[model samples]
Target: MNEMQKPVIGFTCGDLNGIGLELILKTLGDHRLLEICTPVVFASNKSINFYRKSLPDINFNYASGKDFSRLNPKQVNIYPCWEEEVAITPGQLNETGGKYALISLKEAAQALKAGHIHGLVTAPIHKKNIQSADFNYSGHTPYLKDLFGVNDVVMFMVAENMRIGLVTEHVTVADVSKHITKESIISKLKIMHSSLQKDFGIDKPKIAVLGLNPHAGDEGLIGSEEENIIKPAIKEAKHNMLVFGPYSADAFFARGQYERFDAVLAMYHDQGLIPFKSLAIGEGVNFTAGLNAVRTSPDHGTAFDIAGKGKADHSSFMAATFECIEIIRLRFGYAEMRQNPLRKMSARILANAVDEKIEETE
Candidate 1:
């Protein structure tokens, strides 16, 4: 595709001390990626140079700019967020690294809001170090939600075929139960249903909802979440989309039943993530659904142990980038289809008429 036709994807350099920069560099170094989308990294030259020196084998060509007025599709453009002299201690978590990570993220998010970039693929950030007066949020999902003024969003994880979305994210085990109410469940179902249809181009999405307790509370024998909360939510949601089950989480994945559905909605974090990561480790992409914008990130976190050693796997980061590009295209196509439903119906009828005429002539 031409440069104008391709979407410009903005990337944030998550925790400079971590493997964020390494993964970003490794993924963008492949020249073939440029053909699909324009990539702009929101980071500084000093940070990129630090990684380049650490790993001399990986060669990346990039353009440096303060703003994206003139973008070079041929090279990865580095939008300088900061240019200060800071310690570069890889694999060691410090406050300085967190500061830069937040800066990179804030700059990229601003650009995305202004329509300077089409989509965003954020690298992993250190949760503790990144916390500050400016960024008091728990993680990227909530931060993006508040940044764009979106009230509800789902933390949807995607692998090759297994797609999982969480009803409650970044909550403690004790708090998980309190959050699993009928209203919360129904809201998440709506988000997942819309995301599957629009972002994924699924005409009809089959979502398998997982139960909170063992064996789906043994049909209310073990717990009443299934009877009182989950069942009622699914009933209400069926009017909106094809939603089924509060299936037992254990048996659903063990029996390969999840493959039957387009996506799975788990009650909490570990319920869905444990199975997803176990199957798609190093390849999963975390996609934030039900937002006005498209944002994705690697399923994994900052590997502080192997940050500077150049041992970080870039597979998940690469997958996240590819997913972001694809979702953007899918959303555009879905919107176009929605805008001209009559045109599509008319074409379908014309095709049927042509087939009937051919049959008569034959």
Candidate 2:
């Protein structure tokens, strides 16, 4: 037995208007979820119960703050962020919901640092709906980073067995080039590398880097970025990593070459995410790597239109939960090999076939 103690994971309800609340409620309805790890939701109990009653065939016997210690994995536990008097309407955005969402996130981050919880899995939050009274940071990642005063944070989405990390995020398309400097790429790469090795338990992980230009700047004809920017950064970063490319973005994903590397470092958000979402939409898990504490969320955003429709899919939420466990295991030093079990077997099979081919030639 691994004897690895089950970790307590914190959940943040993102935007009340979005399906974040609905998905959180649905994902917890699975009674078997408790057996894997203890889940603590940081949201209002009123919102939670209202959603449960509104949806049919959904049952969550959520434990409140006073009843936290008595919590068992077979049931759900919720840490109330505000009183029940607060009125909440499905598909409505308000300052109250924004305040509550930020409160939950702050509390969860605190609990993680205090060792009260092992990791965190946040529900989707609306960036625009949130008001200044609750938060001043750009996004959850930035807020958490500032709260912890820790640098080196990266966001990656996992789905279809592909992990993609971004060099720039949450900015206009025009600003992407200016942000793609050697320092920026190097910093993001460092974060990605450490996350894969320490938080993801990938020893000597191979990273695939993409070019900023089309067809990798077509040898400097189409764009100068490949020669002046990306290539030089890769050259410097290579001394500390087994990194490859400045590969053409168009063909790298199409040829399935990305699977060869532990992670693909894309120069911009769309550069990496277009292919990722295309392959893993609705099932992709968004992971915030290189944080002091583990945090993940569904790859998609809050679906305000589908908030109370009972139509939101919980697949991405489930993946985020499972990915949290994997990260927990990695941090605890339980992942023994660089390749996960499935990947190790595949590597062995490929090596054996190659040996047989060589023998035949001899």
Q: What TM-score would every model get versus the actual structure?
A: 0.93, 0.88
For model 1 the TM-score comes to: 0.93
Best by TM-score: 1
How far does residue 324 in candidate 2 sit from its true spot (Å)? 0.5
Cα deviation in Å at residue 226, candidate 2?
A: 1.8
Please list the Cα RMSD from the true structure of every candidate, rounded to 1 decimal place.
Answer: 5.9, 5.0
lDDT string, candidate 2, 106-146, tens digits: 78888777767888898877787675765776577777777
Candidate topping lDDT: 1
Q: What 10-residue stretch in candidate 2 is worst by lDDT?
A: 353-362
* Candidate 2 segments whose C-alpha is farther than 4 A from its true place: 66-74, 334-362
The positional error of residue 359 in candidate 2, measured at the CA in angstroms, is 22
lDDT agreement with native, every candidate = 0.88, 0.78
